[model samples]
Structure formats: structure tokens, C-alpha cells
Target chain A: MPVRLFLALLAMFVTGEAAGQVRAIEVLGPRPFGYFIGDVIRLQVDVVLDEPFTLQAGSLPRPRPVTYWLDLKTVAVDDRGINGGLHRYRLALDYQIFYAPLEPRELAIPGFSVTATDGAHRVEANVPAWSFLMSPLREIMPRGTGDPVYLRNDTGPMILPVRRWLSLAIASGIASVLLLGLLAYNRAWWPFSTRRKRPFVQAVRAARRAFRSGSGAEAYRAGLLCLHRAFDATAGRAVLADDLSSFLKTAPAFRPLEPEIGRFFQASRRAFFGADARGAEADLPRTVLIDLGARLAEAERGLS
Target chain B: MVDLSSLFHHSGNRWAGVPLLSVERLKSILLVNTLVVAFAAFTVSGWLAFSAWNDNRVISGLATGRDIAVGDRARPEILLARGQFLMRRGRLDEAQALVPAVRISGDRRVLAAIQYDLANARLRTALRLIEDMKIDQAIPLINLAKDGYRAALSVRPDLWDARYNLDVAMRLVRDFPEIQPSSEEPPQETPEKLWTDLPGLPKGLP
Candidate 1:
């Protein structure tokens, strides 16, 4: 029995939502916008809400005593009850006034009231007076005026409305940069290393700096070996045993620095493996090792 | 297997109006075509009889003019040749003007045939005007073209070329830019609002 009652209440709510009836009315725009003498000006009134009510002017607060120059008429009324619930119906009323042939800046439209009813109960609602300007007509202007002027009470904006949406503009720019950065990182660098990983250039630079510090000669040699291993990972071949000539021939973008690679390898071989000690050149000193590393770094840039 | 039974069930509920549709649309088209073909055959026979009658009428007139009796086919052949030459040169108007003179005077049927020919020439002239985009000038010319085709149809209802030309002329005239009366008032939103409001009204008889 309770479920049945609930279902009946739901059905009633649905039916009530589908029915559109006028209740309160509001004047949306400026009380006074603009008007010319002898010309008819149309003022707009928008119905705020409409449901379980109907409006009649006879039950208003001031019953027909006031007289105004402006003529009011219902222009359009829409009673649509789909999707929007009780707020679907909208009533548009027009207030028209003919020019008084006077150049006065201000004119008043009288207020009126309406009766609201929901069959059993009755209520009276009042609408306030609206004002309008009676201004002189402007002289004929050239085809292209420099810019259009906007009045304080005008519906249109003084400047483009989109100019105030700066946050949206900044957000769009940041999104674009993020999208491009993602594409570039994926295309150029992300596949090779993560944060914990070291790049081939960084490893090579570390070896060169260690050699310059004079104490870590063995560490510098190990660094060079590690860098060579990283380079091999990119080339898909071992580079420690391979001749520089053969490597340069395969990767021709590095062909211009073939002589530098040859010199560095020759000096390293004489210092570490050769039987005849060419004294100063024979001993792998820190300064000589640093210079050789710098030369190798330059060669790597050319290959890249 | 499921699809086969579904298809059979679907076939059972097929539209019942198919028979009426075929007979009303297809049969009418066939009937019209048969009637047009019969009329064309009749017009061909009429044309042959008219040509022979016209020859006899001219020979009789010539016998009266010369005051001597002679059966000569050379003169008629020479006139037909001249008319064909003028028509081939696009001088349809000049050629049509000569057809009446050769038809022999006081022959009512021949005079009607000549009128039909003149009408055809006027229709051709109107078509040329339309091709030039002279719409204002083409309006009168198109009417004359329709009149000429109508006259030919009155005498020879099976002339397909005349019918086709008349149809084309009518279409071209209708395609011309139409002048509309301008409203004095500026564009207002009230009428559109009224139209939009109409859709929300109750749909039943009330």
C-alpha cells in the first residue's frame, strides 16, 4: 500500500512538471535605454517563473487608476514543459511608446499589478514602472565609424566580452605547450633514459672532469669505458674494439671529425699499451687526458 | 537457422499495398507511352497524305497559271531543296516563310501546317534568347514559343521535338530571377517568437 502511494505521488509530480502556467513577470533590461521623438520604442518584459499559477491584471494593487503614455502588449508567450520542469514557460511582454515630439531626456512608464491563482487560492503581484529617454536623433555619419560606442545600460559590451576570459587563454597556451613538450620528449629523448639513468654525453663529461682533477686517473679511464658502452647501446654495436675509420664510414655525419678521433685513440694507445715510452706523451697525465676527452666530446656533437 | 525463421516471419508481415503501387504507377507510364507512339504513327500517315495533296494542289494551280497542261515534278523538288538549304543554314525563319507560298493558295489544311511551321521558328528564336540570359526579353519570346508549339500540336499532336522545345522554354522562363516587394520595417524578433511559440500549443482538435 505504501509503494502504491509512492508511485501515485511520483506520477502526480511528473504531470505537474509537464504543465506550464505563468506566475511572476520581470523587466529584464534597462529602465531607460534610448528613444527618439515620434519613433516607437519597444521595452521588454520577461516572465521569471510560471507554474501552478496564472496572472490577471485586474487583481493588481492599484486597480486601473494610473495612466501612462507607454502602451503595453503581450508580444510572445511560450508554454513548453519538456526537460526544464516548472521553469519551461516564458512570457514576453512589450511596452511601446510613441515620441512626444519633445526633446526631454526622461519619461516614465506607469506600474501595474497582476493576480496569481492556482484554482483554489488567489494572490496579487505588482510590476514596477519602467523609464526611457526621449533623446534627439544623431546626424548622418560616414560609412565606417572609427569604433562603436556602448551606453552604460546597453546590452552589448564596451569591449569584446572574451577579453575578460584571460584565464581560459592562459590555460589554452599551457595545454598547447604541454602537448608539444610531450610529443618532443617522446620523439627525441624519453626512449633512451629515465631520471635515474645517465646519458652518454653526461657520462663522457664526468670522465673529462675527473681527468682534469688529477687524482682519479683510473676513475677517468673507467668513465670513458662506461661512455663507450652507452654509445654502443645507441649504435647497436661494440665501439671499444672497433676502428674509428669504420665507425665514421657507417655514420657519415661524424666523418668531418675523423682526424680528432684518430689522434685521441693513438695517444691513449701509446700511453697505456705501447712499449717505447715517449716520456711526457707516454705518461697518461690528467691534463692530457682532459684535452683528449674534450676532443671526443666535440666529435660526439658532430655525430649527433 | 535463427535468421532464416526471422526472415520468414518478417515476410509474413510484408506491406499489402505493393499491388496497387505497381499498377497505378507502372501501368500508367506504359499506357501513356503506347498512346504517344500511336499518335506519332498517325501523324506520319497524315504528313504523307498532306504532302501528296499539296503537290496536286500546286500542279493544278500551275496548270491554270500557264494555261497549258503539264505534269512536272522538277519544280517541287527544286523548292524542297531550297527550303532544306535555308533550314540547314540556321535561317529557320526565312525557310518557314517560304513554306506557306509553296503550299498552294486556298488550301485550309496546308495553311494550318504553314502556321505550325512558323510557330516552330518562333520557339527556336525564344530558346536562343534564353541562352543569352536576356530573361526580361525572353519572357515574351517564351510565350510565343509556347503558342507556336501549341499550334503545331493542334494540327500534329505527335511532334515530339516541338513538345520537347516547349517544355524547355517553360522551365527556362521559370528559372529567371524573381523580383520581390521589399518591406519598409526593419527586421523584428516578434514574428519568429510567435512561430516558436506555436509548437508548444496542444496538438489535438482543441
Candidate 2:
């Protein structure tokens, strides 16, 4: 293809030199058939000049999006060594066509002008325009007229499964929190500050600890005082051993522990008022106090 | 996209003036919501599974049913239908990817149809193009379709449709010649000697 172009240029150059000028431009590719949108075409421009003239390097075309749907992608100028005193300039131009035509049609690749200088002797020459075939993307033939190939139908998105999962997760989280909260409320934990262990329950815990530590007489005395305080608090009055029957009537919760209550009072009398007070061995030993407190605590459960 | 902290902390405290957001009622409300949401999830998953089954039904139906042209592919059956269309159009990679996804109410017929369509699509197209394309290019599609039809028939021997298509495909494609195995090679006897080797026939009948 280049040899044919060179021969064609040679003929043009002979005529051009005889006319005191030489400029030949040829678009080499983009065959005349099956041309689609987004196809790039290549063109070559050869210029030969008579003596005292040189092709201007700075005058070549700059690449740009040239038209509505066409772009000049690249531009290159090569120096094909001078032959027979005719300066030769080869401009390789690349153009991309993005035109979509329903029917096959011709689209021109606009031409540009180049400059030649001979030390203050300058002349501008123009390359004539060229054209190539342009065709549409879709096939031109029809399959059937009754059920025409319609444009792409609209597609509806299915409900994403993640939304269902997310909702379920949220609900599960809330339910978990609710279950924990209910448990806390019922079990007398935090945020249910009003719910507290009864004083007798506290007394039971203290006595049980005293028994475990084997803190003999002092621990036993401490357990008695706490039991008295719990009895007084439950009866809403100071409860003495003499007022035991009245305390039981007022706080019937202690009725089930009446025997243990009487025992605790008798032991308290022996441990505190009797001469055996401050003895190394307590009449109401820590073990007995622990059992008495435990019975009272069991009765306390029925009260509430 | 749902901010759970905000749902817990936000002004969704009351519904219809019942103070539903208060801690007092929040527990019950949240518990109920949890149950409802779990039910919703189950329902949604079930609904989606049902649609998938329906999608398979439509896909298998597209093999021989109407309104299944290339352009009408944006339906519930689009997932498999698109693959089938692409396969018919000779786009194999995309079609193969959709083969494992067919399920019509967990029916095997749908699976058979899926396989049948995948193979028969190319077979039918190749037959159409036989007049236009060289024999070398058309034979591969014929063989592929033949194999697919055979596979479907193997699973459901009663599938007359698959049987018919198999017959058509067999005419276009031939299986490799079956060679019988033998311990010893046959005797390399000449045509004249074969008569002498025969026990019942006279050696010089002529």
C-alpha cells in the first residue's frame, strides 16, 4: 500500500514541481465497506518541494475532539529524506469516527493546512478533505413485523434478602434485651433499685458467714443482734423476747419460725444476761445461730 | 442502613399514644416485634424461594413455550432465560454458569429441560447455519446437542420430547465407532482359503 502511495506521490510531485509547488495528501485506510461507529482511520500526507523550501515542523495539526462525534486522536510528522531537491514531509494523521448512522452513509474527515518556509519565503498548502463509510450498530433487517424487536424492557429489582435479615436481627436484638431486662426486674438486679433483700435475709447471710469463719462468741452475739433488729423491723416496733407472741401476730411471717425464734431468744438470754456471757464457748454456738438464721430466712421467703 | 442505636434511643417511644418506647412497655413491644420480625424473615425467605421455583418453571417452559423471544428476557425467569438465550446465541461461557441454578418446585423435569435447552439451542442453531457455515464448524454444535439430549433422556426415559429431539440430534451427530475387545486377532485368511477353512462346505465345490 505504501509503495502504491509512493508511486502516486511521485506522479503528483512531477506535476506539482512543474507548477512551482508540491503537496500530496492521501487517506490510506478504513475500507469502503463494513464501517461502524468507533472506527479509527489513518491518513498519510507527503510533501515535496523545489529548492530553498523546507516543511515547517510547528505547523502540524494538534490532536483534539474535532467535531460532534469525531476526534483527531494522533498526529505525527516524519522526515522521509529529500529526493531530487524536493523536500518530503510525511504527516500521519489518526482520526476516530463515533457517528452512528441508521443507514450507510459517507462522513468526511476534515483536512488541515501545513506551512512550508524557505528562510523568509513561506507558503501555506491545504490537504483536501477525505470521506469514509459509516453504519449503525443494529442490523438493518427485520425478523418479523408483527412482533417487532422492542427496546430493552425495564427490570424490577427483587426484594433484597438482606433487609429481611436486618429486620430479624434487630428484632432478635430487641427481644434479647427485653428478656434480660425482664429477668433483671424479676430477679431484683440493677435498674430495679426498689427491690432489695429483706433484713432477715441479710441477717441469715451474716450468720452463715460467721458460722463458716468459726468466729465463736462475738459472731454468735452479732447474729442475735441482727435477728432482733430484723424482728423489730418486720414488726415495725422494738421486739423483745417477752413480746415474741405479739411480734408473731404483727409479722405473721415469723409464725412459721416461732420455735426457732423462741430458741434464738433463749440462747440470746443465756449468751448475754447469764453468767456464761463472754465465755470461750457460747451457749448458742455459731452453728446453732447459723441454723436459727437459716430457718428464719426460709420463713422470710414465704412472707414475700 | 438502619442505625440501631438511634432505634433504641430515638423518639419511636410511643405508638398511638401508648408510650410504647418507655422501658415499662419497651420490653413487651420489643419482644413482640422480635417475634413478628422473625416471622417476617421466614415469610420473606419462603417467598423468595417460591419465586426461584417459579423462575425455574418459566425457564423450563421457555424451552418450548411462547413469548420467549430474545427481547422478552427481563422477566422473573430472566436469570436462566438470559443464559439460555446466550447459549442459543452460541455464548457458551455465560450459559454454563447458569446450569447449576435451575429449580422448578424442586422438580427434576425442570432440570432436564434446562439441560435439554442448553444443548438443543446450539443444536438447532447449528442445523440452521449448516447451509451457511462450513461442515467443520457445524459438527461441534451437533455433537454437543446430541450429548445434552442423551443426558436428559438418561435421567427420564419417558420424556418423549427429549427423545424426539435426541433423534433429530443423532441424525446430525454420530458417536465414536465402538470397537469390540478380543483376546486374539482374527485369522488373516485369504478369500480363497476361507472356503477351505469352512467345516461343513466341500473344499472343491466348483
Candidate 3:
């Protein structure tokens, strides 16, 4: 099949399977998803299990019908499925919760497991966890309405020139120093240099230049080279051909860039080695590299 | 060439338009607003999450059941129900066996109540065995009855029947009066002569 057609079909199939799975449990919840004290927020866990299950009450340290607090009721499960399979089961559990007192609390709808025999094997698949909120009953209500808001300052323009120039100047100065150091350290790093010089910014700038020049292959290579040098600098060690996984580990910030990094690496291998990695050509793009850089910058900011 | 000065003047006029909004000022305002909204949202969400948590807590006095089958979780309701069904069917021994393994505190009181009934049944059994002269078996069963009554009393202290049964057992165990030598009476002289004659007493005893 043609490459584009194949990808489209694969995507369709994955999504199709994802849609059919039933949501067996729901946190019907403290409706409005919020609660106040002295309010009974009715909650029901709608469970559609393959086997008959019981909705028996569990023990609590404090009993309900408490004199000064609202009561939490006990509901028990029926044993309709003492001996049944996942397919032969049809059960839904419903519960109501009351937030009588002003105490704020968290509650877990415990994991439920169903036992099934897939013809030749018996397996248990636990439904994922479910939980809900209990806000403290607010002590005070809102007072009188407030006035309309307005911006009062006219010095907005003054702050911009100082803030923007300072940040940009600092960034440029840092990039320049790093570029000069890399150039002086490794003259033999690459045979060709196209006025692209910073370790991180150079890679991004080179790719941008290549895209502007309408050379996709050059743009792609520049993206990879940028990543390679950044990886080396960040790792403080030589990144080997086979140490990409280790490189990601050495710099965990790049973990979010996995998809982009993997794509670039695949494109580089196929372009240089003359090997055909199916779908590489269709997947590689300049925008992806740019986005990867943006993500990296954001991650770096977070780290700082 | 003909319109150069006019074009330059128009460009200068355009550049002179009211200064564009400062990106820094807009960003700061946005950041502050976002932080305020997020903090409020986080507060509300945390409150909602806690409310949901409260709903899931198991409260006491509610009838709850669990299953512990071999290694299977003994479902309290199933086990308790089975015990009740068995008791109704007159399978007292089987029913009694089911009650002890139920561990859910929510079901403990109910289980204790059932245990009280089981104790009563066992007491009846022990009484029957004693009537039949099955002394060896009756003793063990009577001891079991006492234990069941104790368990019932522990859970339901207000249960008078369990207290009465315990009282019955205490009363049934006969207490012999402590015997002492008579304080006022004189010693018998003839008994000493008899003791000497019988050759057990010393010769000077009389």
C-alpha cells in the first residue's frame, strides 16, 4: 500500500478500538463536583461488571447517624454471581454520600476486581481507581457586590524596553560565548559551517536557515546536529551512536522531546546511510524541530 | 523617486501611532491573573476532591458484608446471610462455623448477634448431651456455650439473655461449704482409747 494510505488506516484502527471499551465505573459524585457541609451529596458508582458483585458496606472508624453529624448509610451487595463468569455478569453499584458536618475529607472508591476465564486462562483485571472531593462547609457567605475594575498605570511601555532588551541581550551573550567555546574546542566538529555558531541556538538557527533556503535535507540535518551538540554539552560526555537512551537519561529534561528526537534520528540514519525507513520522509518536518526547541526552552525555564 | 519624501513622511506618521501594548506588561498581567485563577481553581478542586473522599468513607451502623473464601475475601454479607439461612434450616453447627470468620467491623455487631443465637443453640445441645449421660462431650460443648455467650456479651452488652446464660452456668457449678473443727466441743476420751487399742496410736495416748 502507499505510505500515506497505510498511516491513515493504522490511525483509524487504533482509534476504533479505543472507542468501544465501556466505562464500567463512574464517580456520579458530589454533583456539581463540589460540596458544602450539612449537604448530602448523593454519590453512586455505576459499575458494569461481567460477574455478579456485591456492594457491601465497609467498616469506618466513626459510625453514621452520628448525633452531631449527617449520617452515611450502609448498603450491601447481593450475591447473584457467587458462581459466574465475566460475560455472565451484569451488576451496577449505587451509593449515596452525605456531608453533614463541616469536616473536609477525601474518599476512595476502592478497586474492584473481576475474575474471568478467557476460555483457557483465568485473569483478573482491576478497574482503575476512582475518588472524589469533600470541601469544608464554607463558614461565611459572600458580602456586597464589588466595583468594576480598571488598569491605572501608564508606565507599561517603560517596563517593556528594559525587560525585553535585558532578557534578549543576556540570552544572546550566553549563546555567543557558548558558540565561541565550541568553535575553538572542536574545529573538526563538522566540515561545513554556514554562519551557524551557538550550541543550542545554532542548531535552531541553522535549521531555520535551511528551511528558508528551501533545502529540507539540510534543515533536517541541522536539527539533528543541534540536538547532537546540545546532548553532548548537557551530558558533559561524548554521546555515542548507541547511547541515545542513556543520553535521554543523562538529561531527563529531553525526555519530553522523545518523539521529536526519535523522528530526527530515524530521518538522519535513512538520509545518510541510503536506507529506507518507511514513513521517515513523510514524518520529518522543520516545524517539529522548532516545536521541540520551544518545549526544551520551556522545560529549562521550569528547571530554573 | 517622485514620491520619496511623501512616502517617508507617511511611514514616519505610521510609526508615530499610539505606542503598541508592551508585551512585558501584558504578560505580567496575564501571569498574575492566571496565578489568581489557578489558585482559586486549585482551592475549589481540592475542596471538591475532599468532598468526594468523604462520601466513600465507610460509616458504622451500616450493614456491610465481605467474602473470605478459603483465600477468597470472606464477603461479610454472604457469610452472614449463609449463617442466617443455615440457622433457619436448623443446621446449627454449620451456621455456627460461619459466624466467627466474618471480620468486617461493620458486620461485627450483626455477627455477634448471630453468635449469641449460636451460643443458645450450643447450650441446648450441651443440656441434651448431659441428659443423655454424654458427660465427656457435654463438658466441652458447655465450655463452648460459655465462650459464645462471652462473645455475644462483648458485642451486645445489653443482651440480657447472654448474661442469664452465664449466670446459669455459674450457679450450676456446686460450691461445697468449707468445713472446720468444732470450736466449743471437748475432745472425746473414748476415741483416744479406741485409737490406742487399734494399735495405731502410741501407748501413752489414753
Candidate lDDT (C-alpha), each: 0.46, 0.61, 0.48
lDDT of 1 by residue, A1-304 (tens): 9999999999876764554244346765444656643233344554434466655445433312123233443345555553443434344555444323223567676665555667776655555666766753332221234222111110110111233234444444455555545444443546423322223556566666654555443644554454556546545687643466677676675566566556555555554465323432435444554555555455555554
Q: Report the C-alpha lDDT of model 3 over A93-170, residue by residue, as the tens digit.
A: 433332322345664445455443424444443444446666543222212234111111110100012334344445
TM-score of chain B of each: 0.35, 0.48, 0.43
lDDT-based ranking: 2, 3, 1
Q: Estimate the overall C-alpha local distance difference test score of candidate 1.
A: 0.46
Model 1 Cα displacement at B23 (Å)?
Answer: 77
lDDT per residue for candidate 2 within A1-304, as digits (tens), equals 9999999999877876566554454555547666655456778776666657877878878887677456687889888777776667778887765454547888788777778888876777778788777765544333444422212111111222345544555665666666667666755678885664677777877666655665656666666778778777777788778999987886687787688678778877777787354552344566666677777777776665
Predicted model 1 interface RMSD: 37.6
Predicted complex 2: CAPRI docking category: incorrect
Q: What does the lDDT come to for candidate 3? A: 0.48
Query: Each candidate's DockQ score against the native complex?
Result: 0.01, 0.02, 0.01
Task: List clashing residue pairs in candidate 1.
Answer: A38-A99
TM-score of chain B of 3: 0.43
The top-ranked prediction according to lDDT is 2
Top candidate when judged by DockQ against the true structure? 2
Give the runs in model 1 whose Cα sits over 4 Å from its true position.
A1-110, A116-120, A126-222, A230-236, A241-290, A300-304, B1-206
